[model samples]
Target: MQVKKADGSDYEPNTISAFQRSIQRYLEEKSNLSILKDKEFDSSRTAIAAKRKSLVQSGKGNKPHATKFLTYEDEEALFSSGQFRDHNPEVLQRTLWWYMSLHIGFHARDERHKLC
Candidate 1:
């Protein structure tokens, strides 16, 4: 089995063997082969998840669970406040289109698709 880095990078095969050896040595010393059979793996998975969640919340993770929804009036006030009032029509239209896409859940990755 492969072990992931704390930052969630992929494991090299050599690193996996080293990790397995360390865990095996520790378990042998503890007389806890049962961890290999079950509980510790589950615990480790939970720990990884918790760490990832913490990183995401702390803004150290690049992925975006970072934004919250805006209230309707707040959103309206923001877009209607004349920020783009002097911009060309095409620019305002594109900006509004992007705002609508994001509001409807088209995120960073999804914005690349043809708007069909």
Candidate 2:
């Protein structure tokens, strides 16, 4: 059996499971994106660490903005900056599947209740 969505597209009979799988896939994709973000952040941190170490070892540690390099605080600050906030592609897909699952489940229960 097939179910028709509001857009006139036929959703397969097992749409609940399909929606669940879609949600899981979206979560996995989000997790992968987060890992990529972390790797980028780590690379930047490593670069900053190298620069700081070079400057300090050369007897220039007392210069202005030297504290920024002292404890690698600059990396922490940059990581928290909103530089990669636009990378969430699966957010809308996940939301749509979630809403569709809720709607489908609610309607199914309502129909069962009406027949009882």
Q: Which residue pairs come into collision in candidate 1?
A: none
lDDT of 1 at 51: 57
Candidate 2 local lDDT, residue 64: 51
What C-alpha lDDT do the candidate models reach, one value each?
Answer: 0.60, 0.48
Those runs of model 2 whose alpha carbons end farther than 4 Å from true positions after fitting are 1-37, 63-116
Q: List the residue pairs that clash in candidate 2.
A: none
> Considering every candidate listed, which one attains the maximal lDDT?
1
TM-score of 1: 0.33
Compose the digit string of candidate 2's lDDT tens values, residues 60-112.
Answer: 44545322222456434533563223346564454454445546654555764
Whose TM-score is greatest here? 1
